[model samples]
Target: MTGKPIDGGAGVVSRVVDVADPADPRLDDFRDLNSVDRRPDLPSGKGLVIAEGVLVVQRMLASRFTPRALLGTDRRLTELGADLDGVDAPFYRVSAEVMAQVVGFHLNRGVLASASRAPELTVSQVLDGAATVVVLEGVNDHENLGSVFRNAAGLGVDAVVFGSGCADPLYRRAVRVSMGHALLVPFARAANWPGDLEVLRDKGFQILAMTPDPQAATLAEALPPRAGQPVAILVGAEGPGLQEHTMRASDQRVRIPMSRGTDSLNVATAAALAFYERDRLRTTVST
Candidate 1:
């Protein structure tokens, strides 16, 4: 079941097994990955978190979630190179056609890693020492949820808080869209919406709810100095914005300035701007 070394000559430790059969029992974790009713990523199903493509697979290798196994073509294995060093997981090398047969589609990423879901962090745990965090509510779209994670990573947002009615961030589509940042970023779900906001307040966070109200404080004016304090940027779904009750729980309401006739921004875009503004203000005040 073992194949030759993919790269780096003689010292390779990865056990590469060439499996041509799609129905092979060893490949069960990757079979029928696209089946809506039986996808392995479903929390109700096998509950495994999958990282697709070389970049995400590498990110998973670095994250707390350790891969139980990998399925990829020989080309992708060579591309992964020494990143597989000490991975402690078997690499199931297969042909592209075999991979397509197993996954139920042609996955252009050419690589996949399956890992078990790690225990989720608590709200307080993710918030520890966080200078800025994004709180989301009613964002049920998987792609939007993924975009928020990507934005959070790129814009220096410290953590994410899921209020209610949000999509599972670890869903395969969401994880792929986030470029694996969904796995790297710390996040937690609030046990109680709006009420748990009080906990953030008690922790010295200035909660600013992002809304389309032109009358609200501008993003620049909303973010306060964040030296010894923290800020929570709250956003709801795109069209609905923040719920009335959720908005009322915040310390203040904030809006992004827009051109005339434009009153709203996509939820994730708005959150990124808030994160960027907060980081900008923190840098300015610190300097």
Candidate 2:
């Protein structure tokens, strides 16, 4: 049944169902969000894409990921008032206390939306018509992965490619940390690891592997020659950097110049630097 109607002003026609029982089976999708084994976002769990907070939930609504349902307080429902118009899913309106009981935590975000996982995109699909893509290797930290997506969105990256040893970008924490850009950004995992990099090369992309090695050329040196061409910035996990073979697969090794004693940056920070450098060069050349 379509739930009760909420007069979320400004044409919000969301199906607002008031759910008081924290144990209601219909709320299963959002139950025990903190459970490592039960959280809906885990690939091993329900494999659902869960969006937390009003902004992320709003993005989930606007993204390719369709929300099957949303759970939040009445305040959030009103805040999302206009954005909820025309959504087919039900918005389970619950009290803050009940939300805490159901999710196994005091979720201060005050809103959550759940969507079934969308079909995975192909490497070719993400790379299609792309100028600047960020490729990640061994970046297993969800927060760092999320930050990369955030950085990519803010810094003019076109897409993201996941290499071996990366974390699930759709993980709940990743989605939250990315401020929902994870939902908006197009990304795909490599089917052939370093072998698939040949596809980027075939498409005329110059791949620059990011490293901490002082001997490597800086971004300013390596990027200017390729200013008018397509480029792929490759970054790895924090400590080990890119895998040796992955490094060999790249066309150039580049580094961000550092201050007095700094040797390396966080994976996300390093990726941001690379993204910013590429964007700076692109903007400079275009004008």
Give the per-residue lDDT digits (tens) of candidate 1, residues 26-145.
988888988998999999999999999989998898898999999999888888887888888889999999999999999999999999999999899999988889999999999999
lDDT of each: 0.88, 0.89
User: CA lDDT of 265 in candidate 2?
Assistant: 85
- Residue-wise C-alpha lDDT for candidate 2, range 125-231, written one tens digit per residue: 99999999999999999999999999999888999999999999999999999999999999999999999999999999999999889899999899878879999
Error of 1 at 233 (Å): 0.3
TM-score of 1: 0.93
Q: Candidate 1: worst 10 consecutive residues by lDDT?
A: 1-10
Clashing residue pairs in candidate 2 are: none
Q: Report the number of backbone clashes for model 2.
A: 0
RMSD in Å for all candidates:
3.5, 3.7
